[model samples]
Target: MSERVMPGRADGLITLDAADALWVDLTADSAVPTASAAFTCSPAHARAGYVLLGSRVVATVKASGGQWSVLETEVRRAAAELNAVRMDRQDLVRIGPFRGAPKKERNETTLLRWRQRITRELQELGESERAVRREGGGPSHLAGIDWRRILVERTRDRTARTWWLPRAVVRLLDVAEHTETRWVQAARTCQENTAVPEPPSHPRQARDAGGRQTTSPKGPGASLRPYNGELEGQLYSVLSGKPGTSRRVAGWVCAVCRTAPATVLDHCHEHGYVRAPVCQSCNTLERPDHLYSNDIRVANHYARLFDTDTDDWLRHWHRCPGCRARTTLPLPHLAAWTAHIACRSLRPTHHAPRGRKPCGVLRVSWTGSQNAPRSCLLTVAVDFCPSGEHRVLARVPYREAVERFRIWLAETAPAVAAAAGPDRLDGLPAQFRPVIADTSGEGLALF
Candidate 1:
């Protein structure tokens, strides 16, 4: 902590025996704090300090549970304990490491200031002490103080200065002083053969000397300037995840879609070349669709077509909703036709075994001979059913064959339509028909 000094007395001091006895006897204020504590010049450990803040010492210990108050008892006991053994370092499991070696000062100005602090604390606490009480007409403990303040006050001269403990209390903290020592050796790896900055001989000179520091501006032994990520005259190749640039800035964008424009000096995580940087959108989310699916190809082709037409389409041939695709003419057909020949194509057949007369005129034909004109003739005698109505019909091919033939007809119909452009569709020049069916007697009805 910041040190304070009084002319005749010191502040807090502790004893190892007292600390040991603390847990067993909570009444004893010697418990080592499991938190943080700072020590300055105090009456309890006068020898441990130079002369209050002027030429005094500074020490600290960390507590186990952020118990800062424990630091007071711990440091006091440490100073007293170390002084007894003359040991430089120690290990106190609960308390942190500590150093007794005082930081030598250049002038007495610091010490003078410490003295002023002690004088102020005394002024404030002096009048309040008389009315202090432990439980009944006595004084209460501070963090860990007890009403038995005489021995403590007498040793540290609390009356004259604000004595918190005795100098001998340092021994109580010694057990952990060195063992908790923080030994840090900061090793830097400078592969680029860069210069390092040197430590300041006089702190103020380094700060206020018009930028003229005691340190060498260029030296192999000095510390490297923080770099501030500043790569002068060049980019400070920065590379984290995703696309990045060489140095911190000023690199060309990588033509390679996803690779970085540049690599970080010491680290590179990506698999591709870190050549140049890319724009923010490209790096973060925007990416090209690279797969070639049929939809994609179609879309691409459609896009190309759109460049000229602005719209491209396909024809959907209409079909009977009930029968799916059954139709004489598809909606997509440009032209279609049917050839109607007048004829009586069949006669009724009989159930021969049931005394039924039968003269079924089925259209029967045969090829006459090879190497000769075939007589593939078809005959249908005038026919009558039991109801006696004359009907004419021709047996076309099978269903599939009829469908295929229909498609063929639709295909060739356009050409036929073009030629028929020179003539009428019915060869008689037709008009819309009023369709009627023979449903009356004699199978003939007037419409």
Candidate 2:
């Protein structure tokens, strides 16, 4: 018997008859053949034969050069045909019985038109295939090639050369690693059978015993309610009633952002009134009640729409009395601003009337990319009383600003104690004591 050399395992030698027998064994079973199988072939021999068959198929297909491209063209043509058929059916539904024509006649004419269109499409497809055949690129030339197995193996080989990681394969193919693995398994089955695998069927909703779908229309949880067409119509009417709106004058551009093309009708969910046409992003942001209040630009723009003053909108920017510079800060920074002012008041340089402590109003401002909250320039300003001049007190990095505030709090603890009197220190507000105790490095009982 003539001997053949295997690619792996140090160029292992096996008889041609034994190799044929191993190939037969691999194809005969759905699962990988074991050493104890009736064919008496080891798993290694079976794997080697399987790989050999796959390589031969790949080589045969490659010999036909651009046959895969021809196959892809055919696939796209078929998809276009399917879409055309769907559109034709929709046209028939919309046209119904043509005017001055009987129902039967209308259907027969429609069927004839469809048949003619389909025949023309099929003739074009046949001519293209014939041209490919003339160029030595056709289904006959690539018969028994198992293209799926070839593709999967090629993907695996390329991925192995890089990092042998599924993520690397995913980046190349734009598919989940698990899905790629499933494709590999399916391709292996095709390799065993020496046949092209059929496209996998899409998963469909489960059907009950009565043949009705059991899945909810809303989805798995059944949380979403069906859309109300009447309410939508009413909203559309209200939107159209408004003159010189973006939807009417500027086409479909977003009324708020004026960037993205509008896709949805923005409305007040509480009042059930239409607002304007906006993009999906703006519509989502508008859902929250405090959206306008938090965004000054949006608030001012909407206020103008209603012909109101800018001050009618939420004011986030304040001008310093001393420096006369505008300071913009969000509402959340108000607490920190107040605390910083109180700390400044306790400074020895801030003199007050004989029996009273100095009182002041504080405003906070920050500058940085909103995406990077940790790194920011935090500035605090205080309007000191009597003179009532508002000036910037501390301008530092966010972390440094916080540290300085804490240090000021620690230094002011003795002054706070003295003002309240030692006996009255324990009677300070509960909320004020925890902050003082923590910063002063003293137990809460010491307050």
lDDT top scorer = 2
Best by TM-score: 2
lDDT of each structure? 0.23, 0.29
lDDT of 2 by residue, 52-144 (tens): 121111000110222210111222232232223211111111111112322233221121122122223233456467456445442210111
- How many clashing residue pairs appear in each of the predictions shown? 60, 0
lDDT of 2: 0.29
Query: Please, what is the TM-score per model?
Result: 0.15, 0.17
| Model 1 global lDDT (CA atoms, 0 to 1) | 0.23
Note each model's CA RMSD in angstroms: 41.5, 29.8
Model 1 per-residue lDDT at 296: 10
The C-alpha stretches of model 1 lying farther than 4 A from their native spots are: 1-119, 126-130, 133-447
